[model samples]
Target: MDDRKTLVLTGASRGIGHATVKRFSEAGWRIITCSRHPFSDKCPWPAGEEDHIQLDLADPDGLGTAIADIRARLAANGGRLHALVNNAAISPKGEGGTRLNSIETPMHLWRAVFQVNFFAPIMLGRGLVKELKAARGSVVNVSSIAGGRVHPFAGTAYATSKAALAALTREMAADFGPLGIRVNAIAPGEIDTAILSPGTEALIDDIPLRRLGSPKEVAEAIFFLCSDASSYVNGAEIHVNGGQHV
Candidate 1:
């Protein structure tokens, strides 16, 4: 079995997740990624496709199977899980990249968004608690600035779910602290990801840096929270925005 530290990162096929996979792998850590799509040649991180989990986090009923597979993979690979990055999220849009306000967003859509954005981290953290405790691991949740402040480009469900995720991070830190596990969140603002729409262009002018944030910068923040440099950090939300929160 490979002895490198293992990281289970979700939504690794593109954008922030993709950048995270590269960051961890370059640091000599072994990564196990998952997303809705099947593993392909596109992601070239070390053993990236060899250990990718092709499962949709929105399927709340199917978490048992997903967690079981992940646990098995970790068991096979040195029986340790150093970090789990819950980065997968879905922000559904309507015609013309419209934002679904609180009233217009349907109950089903709300449930789906919460399933991936909030519940998956809970499930993964709970399901993999043993492996995490064994390695004295860390968990970095990928939240968004929408959770803290409303964004014209992001829908209501997405913002609320991310808010809940940040809250959940606090709860998780309290619960997992005794077991030597650290839990934290990174709240990004207007990163150049595929999920962006034309409406995002206007928000850049409001940014203090006068530029959009990069996936690599967010990935570096994630890496810090997971690495020993931030070992004392827990239940904190690191903003990756270009001073947009200011």
Candidate 2:
């Protein structure tokens, strides 16, 4: 097996996922990234050198195939996957103008939000547990403060799905810890990402920090959790919200 560590990251097209890929790449770890979109021609990272897969996480049936492909790639490279980062998520469409309990919060919106935010990651993690256990790997679920609090800025579907994700993190940690696998979560406040719609400015003003976090900052926390640096840390939720919840 290659001595270098390997990581399988989802939602790597941009934002926090992109930052994480760059950080791990710089640290000499092999990275395999997946996204719904094809790799961009203008992608700053070197093409063909790193592993990049295209698949929509929302497709439940395809997740198994995607995981198998990732495992095969890792085996071909003579490396074991040391971490799984579940960073892909989508807010409800047309949620920008809707309030938390707005009548417009349709069931389809909730289903779509949960499909990506809660279900996909849990399913993928469960599928990859064996590889992760063998390598004593960790699973980092990207979550939000909205999960813990009732905020107008976060729609019902988005907030509720994230809360479920956080609970899933704890459950996974408990179930996987006996096997030397760690599970944790990061709840970011207002990060500067295109994921946020236009009306987010009003919500940003409520944050005590008065500014948004960078993708790199969030990626840093993920790296620490994935690495031996946080060996004793498991089943913990790290808040990167600049005291937004405190």
TM-score of each: 0.97, 0.91
Candidate with maximal lDDT: 1
What tens-digit string does per-residue lDDT give for candidate 2 at 114-226? 98899988887888877887789999999998899987667888888999999999999999999899999999888888776566677767778888889999999999999
What candidate 1 gets wrong by more than 4 Å, as runs, is: none
Query: Residue 73 of model 1: what lDDT?
Result: 86
TM-score of predicted structure 1: 0.97
User: Judged by lDDT against the true structure, how good is candidate 2?
Assistant: 0.84
Write the residue-wise lDDT of candidate 1 on 1-246 in tens digits: 878999999899899999999999899998888899999797878667778889989897677798888898888766789999999999988778789999999999999999999999999999999999989999999999999988887899999999999999999999998999999999999899876788687888899998999999999999999999998999999999999999
After superposition, which runs of candidate 2 have C-alpha atoms over 4 Å from their true positions?
46-50, 77-79, 95-102
